[model samples]
Target: MKFEILQFPLAKSAYGGIILPMEEENKSEIFQSPTQYESRLSRPKNQFAPKKIFIILFSIVIVGLIIFGTTRFFAGGKSEQNSEPAPTAEAFPTDIPEPTEEISPTQEPKKPTPTKIPTPKPTVNPVDKTTGLDRSNLSIHVLNGSGAGRASKKASDFLESLGYNVIQIGNAENFNYEKTTIQIKSAKEEFLSLLKKDLSSNYSLGTTSADLASDSRPDTIVIVGKE
Candidate 1:
């Protein structure tokens, strides 16, 4: 007689084991042709896609310019409206010429009194080695400071109250107030920072320290003569 059966039943399906699905070999139906299998595996979209960064940036710039132009146009219109003087009722002339109003020597046609224009306040020269405060002055940064909190107005007001005329306010920060020796603007080579350097060549700027924090507030910068 033949040996008793020692084999077990076949696996129903394979999910994630080392052995792959043997459906092709085990199934009774015919397997797909190599050509058909290759066709199925091939995807229509094979090439990598490129980004449209240039087009996106160009569109953004165009939109920003449009907004800026619209804003400026509206602002310009508003300014022009304010510039025109409204016609006054007295501007209308009578249809019939009335007797000419006699002007006595004592009284004359009221000429609009010209408003007194304020003279440009002189800028105080920095006590540093610079000589004068002119377009040549080389201030690295100008602060638009007012002291913060309760002490905010203290610094600026105190300086002004002391008869100190601040030419430009600086941003609130502790930084070298003087321009660096390096030239930034080529056209300004002959002016501003250069002029200040030449003029103040005789002066000495004292050393800066932690204790030397600016005594001014926001929107106020103090310039004093060198000690």
Candidate 2:
């Protein structure tokens, strides 16, 4: 194998030259100083190191933000669950009502009415129309057959009060006669019947006898007798 040398110019003014083989020229270009070698190696690493540190810090910040957001969401839900409404108070009455009194109704009393009284009626005496003799126009003779004192006089006065004309007043001939006898000289039986109402219950009618004289005989002779 043949070796060859190559010359290289140092400078334009210096005509000296140094020769080196091709392999030696290549070894010089490839070798470096330690400080320069360290500086060259670290410069490439420092340039990419800034990008890796920035990427790692960015990832950590994103994870911290996600954890903080998740924790805040759960805490807000728990706060909402614990909240509740407060109880209301009851109201009481302040004033009480008063009692009232009862009253009764008033009434008035009623008065009684006056009663009516009836008046008495007057009594009337009977009259006869067949004979023209009434109580006002009849002729009468009062006789006392009884032994009672003043009987003829009392009878005469009583007959006069009844509007009768008493012509005679005397005692009977026989006091032993029990019933009174009315001797009628005239044929007027109605006058004798009318006069019997005023006489006693023991009286009877009889015809006038011929023994009685005509002048002494009345129309009706009343003979008093004991009853």
Candidate 3:
């Protein structure tokens, strides 16, 4: 008699290793090598590789920021050196002004003039020609009929002081006479009135001549008494 050979179907495992199919009754007895089992277990660790690549890209970004900040700091210092300084204050002038004209010396003072005075005139006495006896040129005779001592001389001196021309001074015919009398020898009322005013009020008057002689007669005669 002749025998036939059978061929089985092949399949791949999850770790990319080759596997053979077995019957259900012998499935528990199937086994793999240690290397193959480790390979299959480490396959899950490859999923964390993307995390390391991200760390490298982040380090490059930080280095770019540091280089940009250093360039700006050096450029700002160079701009400050090229700028201008602030301006200083200006000063004022101190000049003085000159005079317009020169001064002259003072002039001398003038002299003063003198004034003149006038001379005065002499006074003249007024005259009345109606009476024969003029007041400025009258002849008077005084008698002391009262018999008092020096009475006639006293009356004569008084008449001379008053500007009268006393021709005689003597005692009367009688000393027993009571009141005094005035006799006007020239018969002039104006002279008579003037002689009466000069004598006392108690004395009486008459136009007739006294006991005197004609040659010894005066323009007016006054007789003084005790009354």
Candidate 4:
């Protein structure tokens, strides 16, 4: 009693054979969807992940900077912010003006006393016309202040270096600076000229050009000359 499946031959069969019916065969099941298609349609998304990570990193950096700044600000030992002083317009002044101060009485200013210049006694001699030979205050007579002519400049330089004031007087080139000689025509003529000059300035220069060369003075004559 062995049972086996039999199949029946159709057209072109050499002989008829036994065949199994469709209802007698068993069937296997299959999935409703394709695995590859399902997997592709349900794939995971990654687009916003990097953006989220960057946002998080940026937020962390900002927080870190803020924390670092705050920590340094306190540890650096800086003074606390101070409240502003009250404005003068808002605060009452400690010093107040009185009614008398506002209405100060008007008064006249006193006149300055006149200063009296001392009256000089009349002197026979007059003031001499003088000029400073150099930058020094020492003055000399004549249109040209030096008697040594241009040579007087050297004498002036020597006198200035010696800290002495020197002024030379002459109508013409009368003194030879190299020789230190007065080429005067006469002692009398020189004396008279000096006398007249001394009388004019209340200053006496000399009797002769030689007399004025050195610091010398005629005691009787108010005008004196430096020999």
Best-matching candidate per lDDT: 3
After superposition, the stretches of candidate 3 with alpha carbons farther than 4 Å from their true spots are 1-133, 201-216
TM-score of 4: 0.19
lDDT of each: 0.44, 0.62, 0.67, 0.40
Runs in model 1 lying further than 4 Å from the true structure = 1-51, 86-227
Tens-digit lDDT track for model 3 on 1-227?
Answer: 88888888887865686778978776444555667667877886545577888998898998999999999989888888767566878788867787666444574455576666665433333243444455656677788887889878887766665457789889888886556676665444456566665554334443334343346557667777666
Candidate that would win on TM-score: 3
Q: For model 3, what is the error of residue 175's alpha carbon versus the real structure, in angstroms, after optimal superposition?
A: 0.7
lDDT of 1 by residue, 1-227 (tens): 78887754454323332333456665533344566668877958666445677778889999999999999999999999999999876667659877987889998679999999999766644343343334323232223222334232333343343233334543444334342122223333333343334324433333222222243231212322222
TM-score ranking from best to worst? Answer: 3, 2, 1, 4
Clashing pairs in 2: none
Worst 10 residues of 4 by lDDT: 218-227
lDDT of 2 at 39: 84
Better of 1 and 2 by TM-score: 2
Least well predicted 10-residue stretch by lDDT in candidate 1: 218-227
Instruction: Point out the higher-scoring one by lDDT: 1 or 4.
Output: 1
Query: Worst lDDT window (10 residues) for model 2?
Result: 205-214
- Writing each residue's lDDT as its tens digit, candidate 4 over 20-49 gives 333323311221235655886799976667
